[model samples]
Target: MLVAGCSHFAGRRPLLGYSDKGVQHADTAIVACAEQLQYVCGITGVNQISTWEKFNGGKTPWVRVLPGRQVIRMTLSNSRQLNRQDVIIDNVQAGHVYRIDVGSSGTLLTATYTDLGKLDSYTIHMPRFPLEPKAITASF
Candidate 1:
């Protein structure tokens, strides 16, 4: 069970349309779900992505796509309602981030798509391996 859990964790990847070597940071657009407003159940052209994390610490559900007209199918839900919406994002600019907000207004579920501007900053974590020299002994 422990090994299975570790394997599952290691196999997870972001639901990105382009390959890591093919995508340039400056030319990629990001779409993220607003965790406070709604939960994203799935994304189009990809497997269902989990938007929640342990202790609510999971990074928001986001995908990186080429800058262009993109159709995103989302299953959004709130405390009172659940909705499946097909959101058309047109003319997405490179280096920009878009956020989807779904909420209830007067008993009506509304989804708002907002462009949050360019991605400000990002961090990458890598494991470091130690390099040690073996002890050498000389005989007389």
Candidate 2:
């Protein structure tokens, strides 16, 4: 029984996940420039990972993006923000690091962009989803 109990430890570490192939963004990709993703600015893949490390306890199929060499996890859940049907994740400030709380079961994903040393900041808000959202702009 002891051996069976230890089975949980025999697998890949946490804070790691994989999305479908053909993700259409590298670092520095803006929403208007690339395929419109509802929740991520940059994602990690071959020749595209800005940085990816071990992050734990998030909903399945979340995308990890690197806006400024920092990791931000995008999650979607039923957890509402401010007791309303609005923001589930919030970035109160910019030019800093923020750890997204996955345990909250929230239902939105937000990313904040700021021109440092300036008074300009922009944030993107999107609904929570289990699959990587894609925007089709062209066809072959």
Model number with the top TM-score? 1
lDDT of 1 by residue, 1-140 (tens): 55434323421333474545566656777776654524433344322323333321233255666777877666666567666666678888887777777766766666667997876542222111132322221111
Q: Rate the local accuracy (lDDT) of all candidates.
A: 0.53, 0.27
C-alpha RMSD of each candidate structure in angstroms? 13.1, 15.5
| lDDT of model 1 at position 100 | 72
Model 1 scores a C-alpha lDDT of 0.53
- Best candidate according to lDDT: 1
How badly does each model clash, as a count of residue pairs? 0, 1
Question: What digit string (tens of lDDT, one per residue) describes model 2 on residues 29-126?
Answer: 22111123333222222123322322312222223222333333333333233211111223222222222322233443443333222122223222
Estimated TM-score for each candidate:
0.58, 0.19
